[model samples]
Target: DTAFPAVHWVMMGLNPTGSFTPADEAYTMGFEGREAKKEGDMRLLKERAKELGPGGIAKLYMDKLSGTFADGAGGYHSELSLSRDYGILWKYVYGTHRDYILLLTQLFYLASLFMSLYIVINFIKKDISPEAFVIMLFVLGSFFFQMIWEAGTIYSIGIYPYVFALCVLGLNAKKEGEARKEENDDVRKPGFRYGNKSGFFISAAGFIALIAVHLRYPRESVIVSVDQFLFQANDPIALSDGMEIKQSFVSDKDFSIISLKARNFEGQFNDSVYEVSLKDGNGDLIKTNEIYGKDMTDYEFTTMDFENVPGVTDYEISIKKISGENDLIFLYYDTGHTDVYPKGKMTGITGSDTADLTFEVYDKEEPGE
Candidate 1:
């Protein structure tokens, strides 16, 4: 390395007949006069060596040499950017301002309870009996909301089927004046009215119970088969890119059997391998397996078995691999919605603290099917 000559303007001789030079000692001693400044500086550094610990001086010099520094830049204007979309930003800024969010949350809760009361009122007025609604409400109050944590979407869509089914059950008795009183007069006899009330009431109760179970212990059962999936083009409520499966069931037992035969598949997978896994909340290595293999060129198939697995809260499959793209298919199990639910305050902060019904297999048959 090239050395630069010291270019001090003052000389040691100019200061006094002393061992230290005036220019070198200028900033070395605060108020005390410098004495053998260069040698004294080295001695002072060595004196504090014991307090500084080994390598402390070396690290300090290294830091100075590298020009590295600790910056406090992360404290402000460093929050994670969620999205660049203006609407999303606007929503974040004002849509759920603290007060409004609290109000909405409260209203949603109030509505849930009010709707239940309304359901009960109409049920009694219609002179119907409990079928599934009993089980449904029990499950809802027990654990579905707090456990599953599926809000808004489930209520918006899930309540539809239950209401529609209940309405069908409710209106089945409402009849028009018959063209011929003798032929169309189907006034259920007073004695037979007991049976009609018994059936509809029992059904309504059962419906409530089914929804409650769906919310409480969603993963307990899965509908592996359906009679016929409602098509979006036909059923306006079923509108979505997702296909709906009609027949579904839940399990009361853990590690329950789930089997599905691949019905149909059509896709051109370029390079990737389809992957599937059962993941728990913490995302520890739970259970994973390759979904489809190369030999499945004709009609690809996939199956995974889990043993001694505790209750699961969520599950999904992904066509993922470093290679490129892939695809696979399932039978009536496709497009199944969430049934596992999270319930109560601080649900996410707690674990397996949710409540659910001990019964299973809520819906076994569809009327008129």
Candidate 2:
């Protein structure tokens, strides 16, 4: 069975010939390279792989499988490991708002755990059906694989059916147990029975409470925007002459603010002047602002606001070091070929033509509209 699946995966290019680390590297390189030359970290990884012999490659593979590679933070599959912390997974699945939703999700996760334990206990007592036992095995196997190897929310999709099956089996077992208890005792339990007055009032009260809370606190409306920061921070573009980075964007609606991620290296204070200018489609300057290096924070978005800018579609933002002796300010960018913002293209970075600066464009929103 393993051999057949292994052969199939290899044929489909799902499984590569090298160890897991190299396989990840190959996949990233192929996916993000996009006909561009592999430079920087990608080139370094390829060289490092060639230097590693068979024994070294095997050790790396074993380390990743055992979840000991960089304390489970080294591989691409380490997303689930990192998200194991409290509220991290919830925030990833759901947006930052809606604390009530996070609490409900946590309750469901707890219920699933109890369901698993119930299935295991019934199986041990030889009271569960064969189908349920198989479903339990599949669920447990998926969990074990996540614990040992790579795990992500995406990987959990494959075992959703088994999980739903286990839930049904657990519910059926609970009802059957209740039925047997009633028959043996020859008496009916009185608490929270369906089709009863007490149950109907309690359920209605709960539903009304939920509705009240929802009406009192509605979810925040999220602004629709184009974000082109896909990959991790690449080599920062140093502020220098002839290195003026410009990002052009088009928006269907009116926009007043454009934010760019930047880093300040000069210890909280510097005497450098960073000029940010907004240019029109025909190379006409509309608005410009000068930001002192002392005011900028490290690895944070610097927002440049345009005043009295009406519904313009095509606009360009330029950032250059007007007065700075040393490289005090650096702009971050994405070297990968995301092409997420097709209406935008970044220019003025050395050694790369297709690279785009990490940026986000926000549409103007009116207050109390």
Q: Please report the candidate that would top TM-score against the real structure.
A: 2
TM-score of each: 0.21, 0.56
1-369 per-residue lDDT for model 1 (tens digits):
011112111122112221223233333433232344444444543454554455664453333222211111111111221222213333333222122333334344443444445556555666444753663465344233322121112222334344344444434323211233435666744665366578557756865675676456433222221111211111112101222212212222344222323322233342334443444444455565553434344322333464224464433222233233333333221122322222211111112233111111112222222
The clash numbers for all candidates, in the given order, read: 39, 0
- As for model 2, its CA RMSD to the true structure in angstroms is 10.8
The parts of candidate 1 lying over 4 Å away from their true place are 1-252, 256-272, 293-301, 311-369
Candidate 2 on 162-247: residue-level lDDT in tens?
76678778878877977888789865656625534764576568656866876676544323244554434343557776568788
Off by over 4 Å in 2: 1-114, 120-169, 175-185, 195-222, 233-236, 326-337, 350-354, 363-367
User: How much is 276 displaced in model 1, in angstroms?
Assistant: 0.6
Deviation from native of the Cα of residue 296 in model 1, angstroms = 5.4
Angstrom error at residue 186, model 2: 4.0
